[model samples]
Target: MSRRVVRQSKFRHVFGQAAKADQTYEDIRVSKVTWDSSFCAVNPKFLAIIVEAGGGGAFIVLPLIKTGRVDKNYPLVTGHTAPVLDIDWCPHNDNVIASASDDTTVMVWQIPDYTPVRNITEPVITLEGHSKRVGILSWHPTARNVLLSAGGDNVIIIWNVGTGEVLLSLDEMHPDVIHSVCWNSNGSLLATTCKDKTLRIIDPRKSQVVAERARPHEGARPLRAVFTADGKLLSTGFSRMILLRRLKELALASPPGDAESLGVVCCDCMPTAQGNNFEEPVALQEMDTSNGVLLPFYDPDSSIVYLCGKGDSSIRYFEITDEPPFVHYLNTFSSKEPQRGMGFMPKRGLDVSKCEIARFYKLHERKCEPIVMTVPRKSDLFQDDLYPDTPGPEPALEADEWIAGQDAEPVLISLKDGYVPPKHRELRVTKRNILDVRPPSSGPRRSQSASDAPLSQQHTLETLLEEMKALRERVQAQEERITALENMLCELVDGTD
Candidate 1:
């Protein structure tokens, strides 16, 4: 007689619980833009969501503490001339956010701590290089002020937001639209999926595709890929399958078999020096047959990966291990209403005292709900096993250092005493003038014309002028206060005399 073996895992009993109704953000006008990008983004200090606007694109930024019904006329960060496709909060700075839009530009905004009375109509810096609408934005994992954007024109541009300059542009890699892009732990390599059914590992600094696997999934639908904690590639496609491959192996060997299997395929990209190749058999799991795409959010602390399907009312999480079944199913968090989009909070933002392992912001039709996942424990003491040193807001490397081929892991911070967000920090952008560079010896210098200035430059000038006017008003108010104080002092002295 054969006895069945049970899997022993700490996260096996983990459960997800939704916050109370009063804790949810209500009456939000979620955008109806028909795009694959997640409409919501959240950090420890604020929650941002793309909303429908009349003339152009806009997104509302609400303090995390403001939980009740949002005012319909709540001020928005509006500047994009078209619908905002994606927004990503900078990992190194909570107050900094980058947004991609249909206007073929990427704008970085500096969010203030206090809520603004009027809509913010200007961005700290606008990056314009893509010839088509930008659909994806991802910040460097360990570098400061470094951002990456993928556009519809089949181009990927790495930008240094500190100086508003293009660090590198990988325009020759993808022949079709890029579906998704993710950075590794050190931000030295990038894993991207494209519409041409290809998975590529790119080194932006080298401007080359180090490795690529064509048709990782034999489906017409788009594919999404991300870097695992161990520097492996985990990809999901519409063919109801997930593929895990080691990056080292991918760089050494070529994929041998066709990806026609309809289950989890673990390809051994790394082969031995003796030229021996071993392939793991496919493991199958029955998933929902809905057309909704699966968005996988991975937590490196717990080694848990949550799969949130668009337009689905359930979130399924799995634990990854080195055992036979690498991906083990934990449990599903179900709700009545389907989620339009989802925002995942970083590990540092979780409450360690409550044993909170992960938190998600689920976007509904008109509201946003918070779902907390915790590991039940009998003791109230800090669970060291549940909480590990996670990536904090401090950057490990600067943009220039990263561009110079330096790689560093993210700065880790302990959450044993609970994490406190830092005070509001400003993101300053210093733009370089093109006119400062002299003309080539073969070409004559031409007179600069105001009409020849780029729209972004003109906007920057207007923003500077506005700043000057505001400063003048502040000075005038100070002068008036001083004069009034002097008059009051003189009257008091006369009375005393």
Candidate 2:
């Protein structure tokens, strides 16, 4: 028997334009994943929309603003010999962009500090490896210059943008065409949903997937998959065992429970496969999918993964937890206007001061609308209550290092403060100078930017006291860790003697 559900989501939608006018395109490919940006890379100054270029063999970048139409003088990146399938903005550099093409090549292009032209003829780097059309591309969440791409040949490759090299290629895992591939929070493990109806969790360093769940979904549909904030587990505390395992156990990783029972959902829309006696899939009544890829994006800091479908006009999000029914259904955000595509702004680009944790730019027939999701708070005041704790540590691999064959430190969320938006002046991407790859000096905590935030709030005694208290606690915690390590060392020494 399937269980019926009624969920009330906390998210509220507010639609506004990312540009000044209603931006329109000719047969915009919102039906497929295009990887266009809703906001600019450097300063959030412009919104990027992908359009079918000229006839059909290429894609053009349409830049818009809240003030005017696309600047004709602004250069359009045009190099693909075949139709461009998707594009991704570099997470670390606002000046950099990447596009995947049906010509079986991926091109990396750099935007000048100032350029005036309708199109650019060359790319900074061209990564050509796929035997068939390259269709998907994604940048690493934390690391710079690393990229992942999947193609029609049923293969995936991790690329190094700094040197333009193929760092790793995964070809033998999926029996059929690849549907979607996702990098967990820190880029340690990659989860792939494939036409074979299997979900594979990979240890990137080994070049082989150590675990997999067959037919995690019952429907014969292209689905999306992701690792929750905690590795492998879709939600925190979703299962008691998942929460209790040690970090090392998660590395070579023993799964917390039977893959069928813990990972697959027993949904009414999903039917059990031909010969498996797994636990029943969860009943997810909100999803209305007839076809196309259902891509999922997980925000580790917020513990939310939004699932968006290409054919469907609705987006359903779920909250991950440590507690079965580990993936709790949050409400679905629907619209009468179906989207051709969608773009999610990064955490740094969000307006957390207003308790805004997430922003999605949905492409309609005529305009790109910004949908803001926030936690409800009574005070207009900075709600530390709603934000994520401080960001976890950086990846162990440095820039230019190949992600393949190295064990990555799991991406974690350490609590201290939450998503604080970039300042308005800083956000004036159009009016600002390009940022250097690395600031001359950076620290654990950047003294907040000289934003328009009130000086009274900056100099408040309570603020100072709070800062000191947090610093002291961090120091004391470090000392305790050291003491424990020293004792372990001493015990080892005595045993040796």
Candidate 3:
């Protein structure tokens, strides 16, 4: 007879508490886009959410400190001609953010430290390479100004935002639409899941698939994948089981169960050192039968993985360990309303004094609420175990260095003294001027060069000119309206006199 041993984890007793009514952001009209995006993005300084705009795409950015009812006419970050699908904050710069829209373009904006009095209608630079709606955006984990965008065209374009140029375009990797894309700890490799029912580990610099597994899940539903702290792949899909694959071997390891189960399955890849071959996935856990897609957010500092379903009312988190039960269920944060989308705060953004292990901005139909997960502590001093040295705002590598095959871990910062967000840093784009290029000194070549500008470049220039003209006209109309209102007020004052 053997006794069953129970696993112990500090996060086992962690409980989630919603912020006070005054602390939560409210009265915001969340976007109604049915796209499979989080629709919200956050950093230590600001909270951004895709919102409903009349004629075009727009998202609202709010100062994290200034929480309460948002004014109906609050300024927005608007420039996309179509509905914005996804938004991601740059890990290295708190003031910088990237947005993807259905207009087949990506725009990066630099938000100011103080709230703006008017809408930020212009982007620092516009990247127009995707031929279809761009739905997913992810910034390089360790590189500054290196952003990745996946579009409906089934192409992934990694851009150097600082120079307004495409660094790498992985156009031929996935045969179908890419459902999800994640960077490893060092940003050297990418873990992506595509609609083709396959999971791939791609080395974007080499433009090659290092390892891949076909049909990790048999269901046709969307799949999501993220790299763990140990560099293993953890993927979840509608096939009612999560499949974990070892990157070295591309073998699947999942919990023992019927792969035909009718629910979302969560699996963690077991690390292995062996030959490259496909192995059956072993499932670690079976989730609820809800149709909502589970979005897994991994915290490398804490070794904790939070699973947030799109339309679910609760957030379930797990602790990944090296023991038998590789993934341990911690607890679920339940609420009354299902979250339409969620914004996860970086570990550095959490309040270390409050013993906050994780923080989430849960999006509702008409409001955005803050949910804090804390581990109770007996002492008031800083808990070293709970708060480890986490990735800070400073980047470890530049865009060019990363593109040139250099990899470095994120620079870590201690939370002992708490973290202070740096002052606003503007992202500058150094676009190449077409006129700067000198044509061949030879006669025939010089004449040909005058009319040989790339069609795409010409189209982009024309688009920018049209947008500037429209904006000028809009400003002029507003000025006239203001003058008319001032005259009317003056007349009323004279009549009263």
Which candidate should be chosen as best, given TM-score against the real structure?
Answer: 3
TM-score per model over all chains: 0.83, 0.65, 0.84
Q: Sort by TM-score, best first: what order?
A: 3, 1, 2
- Candidate with top lDDT is 3
**Residue-level lDDT tens digits of model 3 in 290-384:** 77877888888778888888899998888876554466778888888999999999998999888998899999999999999999988889999
lDDT of 2 at 45: 34
Per residue, candidate 1 scores C-alpha lDDT tens digits across 1-497 of 99998888889999999999999999998999989888999999999999989898999999999999999888899999999999999998899999999999999999999877568877899999999999999999999999999999999999999999999999999999999999988998888989998888888999988778776655566777777686656666655234532111111112223222223334431222321121222332345556676787888878887888889899988886544345677999999999999999998888887888999999998999999999999899999888888999999999999999899999999988999999999998877766556445565536466335655576787799789979977976796688689989999999999
Q: Regarding lDDT, does 1 or 3 come out ahead?
A: 3
Q: What TM-score does candidate 1 reach?
A: 0.83
> lDDT at 382 for candidate 1?
90
Per-residue lDDT for 191 in model 2?
78
lDDT, model 2, position 220:
53
Positional deviation of residue 471's Cα in model 1 after best superposition, in angstroms = 7.9
Superposed on all Cα atoms, the candidates' RMSDs to the truth, in angstroms, are 8.5, 22.0, 6.8
lDDT of 1 at 307: 81
- Model 3 scores a TM of 0.84
Which residue runs does candidate 1 get wrong by more than 4 Å?
Answer: 240-286, 440-497
Q: Which stretches of candidate 3 lie over 4 Å from their true place?
A: 1-3, 240-278, 443-497
